[model samples]
Target: MKIFIIGITGRVGSLLARSLQDRGDTVSGLVRRPDQQSALQDAGIVAAVGDLTALTPEGLAELTGDVDALVFTAGAGGGTAEQTTAIDFGGVVTAIAAADLRGIRRFGLVSAFPEAWRERHLGAGFEHYMDMKKHADQALTHSDLDWIILRPAVLLDEAGTGRIALGPAELHGDVPRQDVADTMAELLHEPQITRQILELNHGGTPVAEAVQAAVRR
Candidate 1:
């Protein structure tokens, strides 16, 4: 499959790009910095330098012309509420519009566990981030395209365990960045897992089995 990955320089996005390429899939990555182009090239992915903040139809047509699926792994990182909304919320809106125009239906997003914002109350520092993610998820849910939203609890850098626990948005536990990447890679090819919000965490169950169960639902 030809896959277009946004924010491919990010921790999870980089891992996913490499994993997908290793599996013999054609991978295309979008990045902001020209210096980061080598990273995606090293992973055997075609790199396109562009800013998500200014994602346009012409730009998207050029970047995503022949892609089969799109993964939104972009974020504003640590910044003010306005900045977060600009990149997180606004960037997704642009991507969605581009996908619609290009006739690409499969979409995936990296979201935060909602519990962090609703129950734990991580404070205003992260409040905008959470709201932006939630709004993006809601918008995707209402779109006609097939979509999957993976909300992983505070992502960790540990090696993947090849196992994951999947549930609704309320399920809570930490998951490795590698595991999230693996799950996204698998979903890129699985059509049955559409229009679902999956929460991922490290656990005793195999990741494939967990995803299969989610697909069954």
Candidate 2:
């Protein structure tokens, strides 16, 4: 499959890209600088140089053309408030539009758990981040596409256990970043698991089994 990732430079995004490439899929990513493009090319990814925050839907569609699937793993950390909205909320809007235009229906979004930030006193940045994530998830749900929203709990940088708790569960606990990417990779192969919102955490269930369990439920 030809897979295009929006945030291929991020933690989960980098892992997801590698996983997809390891499995023999054609992977492409939106890269901002020449250095990133060179690095991704060295790692066997087709790097499309462009900024989603600056691109219109038409422009984004052009970059994502001929791809079999699209996965969004971008976050708003370290950017300004406007960039946060652009990368989080606006990015989804453009991707949905671009996908619709290009006749690409499969989309996978990496989002934060709803309750992960709601029941806390996180600062304005976090609050805004959650708001945009919620809106992005909503946009995907309303679109005419085969979309899967994975809301992983607080992401950890620890090594993966190859297992995760995945389903429509209450938001709690922290999941390793590799596990989330591994689960998303598993999800790309399970197209039958469409239009669902799933929560992810570190657990005893293998990634494939966890994804299959969600499909069964």
Candidate 3:
């Protein structure tokens, strides 16, 4: 399968891109800077360079042209609330609209747990982050595409255990970035896993087995 990943240079995004490539899939990464192109190429990913936060629908259509699916992991990364909203919420929304226009139905969104939505954690840095996350997830939830939203708990850079708890149940804990990437790679190949929001953490069944079980739910 041919897949495009937004924010493919980041920790989770880069892992997902490389993991897909390892599985013999054609992986393309959307890079915002010219200097970033070589890194993706080095990892054997086709580099589609453009700023999703500012790209028009036409430009986005061209960038994502002929791709089979899109995985969005873009974020403002501790920037101001406006910038966070622009990239986290606005960027994903634009990509989703562009994907629909291009007739791409498969989308994967990397979002955080909706802790802020449940309890108002106003004024905290985390509150702003979750607010943006809530909107982005909602946009995907209502889109025409076949979407899977993965809400992982505190992201750790530790090595993957190749296992996880994958479901809609209220799972809370830290999850390694690599484990999240593992689940994403499996989700892409499993057509049975569409239109669901699942939480990921470091425990329980093996990643693929957990995914299969989650889809059967």
Candidate 4:
């Protein structure tokens, strides 16, 4: 599979790129800075240097052309509402449009749980983040593509356990960044898991079994 990751420089995004490459997929990323290119290349990921917020749909389509799938893990992180909206919400909108134009049919996004549910647990400081994610998820849901939205709880830096609880709609508790990457990699090849919104956290269900169950359900 030839895959392109939007924020390949991010923690989850970088890890995901490496994970996909380790499994022999040709992976590329849309990077903003030249400095970030070496890191991606070191991990065997092709870097297409460009800013998501600056690219036109035609430019984006050109960059993503011939890729089999796209993984979006970008986030603005504690910036103002406007900044978050531009990168998280606006970036996704552009990528989806580009992917549609380029005929890339599969998309995987790392999103957050519902704002109402998350606010109850994590509390405050997340208004804009949640709002942006909500809109981004909605855009993908309404697009003409096979999409998988993985809403993981607070991401931890701990190593992956190769097991996760993937619920159809909502789940609570922290999940390791590595586990999230692993799960998304699995979903890339899973065309049967189309148009599903799933939540992930540390649990006993094996990743493959959980994904299969989600599709079957």
**Best candidate according to lDDT:** 2
Q: lDDT of candidate 2? A: 0.89
On residues 92-133, what C-alpha lDDT tens digit does candidate 3 reach at each position?
999898898888899999998665244544566768788789
The estimated TM-scores of all candidates read 0.93, 0.96, 0.94, 0.93
> Which tens-of-lDDT digit does each residue in 90-190 have in candidate 4?
99999899888999999899998663355565444477678789999999999988899999887899888988899776557888999999899988878
Ranking the candidates on lDDT from highest down gives: 2, 3, 4, 1
- Provide C-alpha RMSD values for all models, in order: 1.6, 1.3, 2.0, 1.9
Better of 1 and 3 by TM-score: 3
Better of 3 and 4 by TM-score: 3
Which regions of candidate 1 fall more than 4 Å away from where they truly are? 117-121
> For candidate 3, what is the lDDT?
0.86
lDDT of 1 by residue, 1-217 (tens): 9989887889999899888987899989788887788866775778888878877866775777678898999898888888799878888888888898888888999988877536676788688788899998888888898888989887899999988888774467678999999988887778898888888877777877777877764
TM-score of 1: 0.93
Error of 3 at 100 (Å): 0.7
Residue 50's lDDT within candidate 1 is: 84
Model 4 off-target regions past 4 Å? 115-125
Of candidates 2 and 1, the better by lDDT: 2
Give Cα distance to truth, residue 155, candidate 2, Å. Answer: 0.6
Cα lDDT tens digits, model 2, 52-109, are 8888888989998798899999877757779889989998999899988888889999
